[model samples]
Target chain A: MASTHLKRTSLYDVHRAAGARMVEFGGWEMPVQYAGIVEEHHAVRTAAGLFDVSHMGEVEVFGPGALESVQRLITNDAARLIPGQGLYSPVCLPSGGIIDDLTVFRLTGDRFLFVVNASRTERDFQWIAEHTRAATARDRSADLALLALQGPKAQSILERLTRADLTRLASFHFTDGLEVAGLRCLVARTGYTGEDGFEIACAWDAAPALWSALVEAGRPHGLAPAGLGARDTLRLEAGYMLYGNDIDETATPLEAPLGWTVKFDKVAFIGREALLAQKARGVARKLVGFEMQGRAVPRHGYALQAEGRRIGQVTSGTFGPWIRKSIGMGYVERAYAPPGTPLQVEIRGRLEDARVVKLPFYRRS
Target chain B: MYPKDLRYSSEHEWARAEGGRVRVGITRFAADRLTDVVFVELPAVGAKVTYMQPFGVVESVKAVSDLYSPVSGTVVEVNAALADTPEVVNSDPYGKGWMIVVQPDDLRELEQLMPVEKYLGLIGEPAT
Candidate 1:
């Protein structure tokens, strides 16, 4: 029995009307697909795709210490984020284990917003609130709805609906009060698919209107209303880690190969000491991207074997629709983390051949 | 859509009898649930399979599922074409998407499977 109450987005009715296949994901009854997974995945890559990311959580931080609190809470250098800019970071426990991977937007010099994972909303908010002394943290997950319009045609499609000069909105920059489809929304030129796109954040109840407008305006551009299924594959192809899947409480950012997110120079943050120690001693095991040598689909929890021994386990694996290869990511002994290292993933009792490759399996051309 | 001439298993496999050999594949309902099937692993020809047992694997980008056998038999043929172009399973699940042909050990085994009407009922589809 599902004990936890499942949440639904404001676009729930619209998704149902569109004949989306619904599935329970991280305590939310969300649409996993609309047209089809591969179809929607292709649409996002080739043209454009709209996504309902309403289930993702948002934590608002305000007050004089907002910048200080955010800097201390995350592994990345949030102080480097100028107003109207956002940066991805990992919220880590004091033990250096990842609490969540979130994006912090600097709305003002003293105001910040942390966009967190749906499942980690409560944990991240509590962690952030407890650690901050002067800044106030409020969970705004219920107040906001996020939509991501991604792909090559994303800018052109969104341009038709809004008068704003999106071309001037550089990547990782956001305008909090941009009017889109006659509604004031926060539009960010950031995306998870490694493509040029915009993440539109609007009031919770206005998502349906925004969604319908985007769908209508994007009709000529071949925009598909994609769902979680396509979202997963897109992120995977881009080598973006899914919190619970690729990184978790037991894995540190260094082990996750997310050392770039850890800024050791910034006035001592959580997990800074432990990460420094890990760096000095060298990470015992490291995450690496891999491609299957055969057709066997390596999946989560599958073992990574090398030299007749189990080296580590697969964290995430899938047949990437865009890349058209069986690609995956997993932690392996530091020795086997190098690109081109031979490896094997035990799938369904058989040791299938695999080899470590680069992090991203696909890059937008 | 479930065809009337075929028999179906509760696991969503369809078996169409061609004399003693039954052509087997997943139903449209199953294919829809497993959207964008990218890879299919079928049993080799002459491999033995049991009734209601897993005979192969069908993997989509999101998940992997087993293909259940509808009757005890030996694999006579496999849709090797699926290895290169598995999306056909989503487009033509009943025709070019056929997974295997099995020579049943017992001809009467077909009767144990559900009729199209019963299968539609099993999947909560309105039986016409």
Candidate 2:
């Protein structure tokens, strides 16, 4: 896509000044790398890394029926979440096909926030608006900028700038009205990368100052300003799924390795019935992780073969720098989903040996 | 900037002809654009390579691009070091990053390749 018309985040100047390589990502001109992908990836794995995730969209649902509306719209049981808690879930079509995978944060008993993918912001907003009964949904994307401080030292780096007791904040929980770098922001103890981190959402105009402060505070901790490239590799290593690359509108939670996110026991959700039926009959296809047995790097759209026949296609693949090996995820027939099953990835017209491993090729200790 | 002594291919490869044997590697331009070469798959040492044909593959963190042979030849020697240190292709594209040494099928094909000035123009890089 032409980057000329792409939107720039509030930290555009900062990224440019740092010599970040900018690319068109989901309608936004975002940094894909700063120093380099591998360097930034290692930094996050070993120390800390800061990221501008302002491209992500946030929609706030407010009213007496907010909880009910969220429960009906998302596959996860939002009602189970008390105030200050968040949960990852897939918003699905009536057919059980995934509309978007998102995180829902319960700010209060009658207020909630849905953090949706940047590419699906408009669609998600429209879908939620249409499905909302008495609740009101407002798109807060443009007004807010999100930053992720991730890695082993993320807590230490953030704690230096904030008075909030980050040690008490558990995973998947958020605190609002927190003063980060002297700027009021919502701090969520969550991240796409498997590392311990906090995602801070602050006013758009205040993002530059907040980012500068975090970078300054994190310097002693070996923090680097990472970009989308490292973000992809880090999340993949952590076994987190990318919405467009891993799961899309055509796949359902059951088949996309996200069955855990589908709360079948919930009262009723958009795709609950279809998912329940699929559970009863068993899903025909399943997403599985695999590792290349050879040096060849598996890539997205590469054909997955078994017994000399094309059985599936790689949904997402990359050389896991942290793992020091090539790993990927793909959907194949249920019978071939077993770990250790022999497979081959057709890369550049050559079939390279691989085997089905387990999901989450890498996990934090 | 590209080395003036090397001949350039439109596909961003460079060749240093020494008699009938030519050393080949991707240019500095290609390396910068690729930004951190993570993996490289080279043709077998004895394999036949055709001009402008894909003889190998190079992968960066975000992309996989084919490495086109700058000249048809027999791959007499491959840079085995790249298997463990692919970033050399980025760090020293014209030196330690040399991918393969080839015995060209025809010396006349060298005349068809572009000189440093023309190659720089093709990529819109100011000639140094």
Q: What is the interface RMSD of each candidate, in Å?
A: 0.9, 1.2
User: Tens-digit lDDT track for model 2 on B1-128?
Assistant: 69999999999999999877999999988987887788999989899999999999899878888999889989999999999989899889999999999999997788789999999999998878
TM-score (all chains, Cα) for each model: 0.98, 0.97
Model 1, residue A303: what's the lDDT? Answer: 96
Q: In candidate 2, residue A99 scores what lDDT?
A: 90
lDDT for each of the candidates?
0.93, 0.92
Q: Per-prediction TM-score, chain A only?
A: 0.99, 0.99
Most lDDT-accurate candidate: 1
Chain A of candidate 2: what's the TM-score?
A: 0.99
Q: Quick one: best DockQ, which candidate?
A: 1
Residue pairs in collision within model 1? none
lDDT, model 2, position B14: 96
Candidate 1's residue-wise lDDT over A39-149, tens digit each?
A: 999999999999998899999999988989998999999888889999999988888999999999999999999999999999988998998889899999999999999
Q: List where candidate 2 sits over 4 angstroms from the true fold.
A: none
Highest TM-score, which number? 1
Candidate 2 chain A lowest-lDDT run of ten: A292-301
